[model samples]
Target: MTWKKLDQIRRENPVTDEEEYGQAYAEASLAFELARLVYGLRTQAGLTQTELARRMGTTQSSVARWESGGSLPTIDLLDRLGRAVDVRLELVASHHDPTSSKDSPSCAVAFGAR
Candidate 1:
């Protein structure tokens, strides 16, 4: 493919409406939240992920995965993460009801990944 074609592909696509814009906003917000959590934890410990891993007796790759949410950390790992950041990740229930209940938990209702 030509450089021009590649450049065009790299450019942001236009959003057509409020619905599309809100969807994009939600996805981007989730990504930002994940990144921020990772960064905050590492920085609070006054260490990079590598250094924090060293202190936590784990591999930097492990930390990297958790930070990016590529892999969810275990409860144990989350406790360690909290220690590293001097903050806790608490579990809170949503006020919104699930689309599917135990009797009908088969279908998923989402606008998209967002």
Candidate 2:
């Protein structure tokens, strides 16, 4: 489905209708984004999931799961992926006060490939 359609559906029947569901949806979206990044980087480097997995000392299935957004890698695995793909993942966390709408907590991930 198109993103617009998905968004319209979300507006009508949001997966995040509740606070807990919202949190879960956010986490899942993050996972999917991470998976897409991994797939893109791997392909850009001309490596198959199996080759990338071998470089990371894991199995192709594990890499597939990561790319499929079915599972998340550990911090250690993330580090390995960064190294293997010659990319850097920098995360910055900014604190926010509950009363300040402009200063809400935020996360920034910078992806730089060397």
- Candidate with top TM-score is 2
TM-scores, one per candidate:
0.49, 0.69
* lDDT values for all models: 0.66, 0.84
In the range 1-114, model 2's lDDT, one tens digit per residue, is 999998998789856458889788899998998899789989999999999999889999999999999999877888788888888976557765667665454877664444
**How far in Å is the alpha carbon of 54 misplaced in model 2?**
0.4
Give the per-residue lDDT digits (tens) of candidate 1, residues 1-114: 999987787575555688988987787676667667767768776888888787667899988876775665565665666666566565333444566454434344322111
Clashing pairs in 2: none
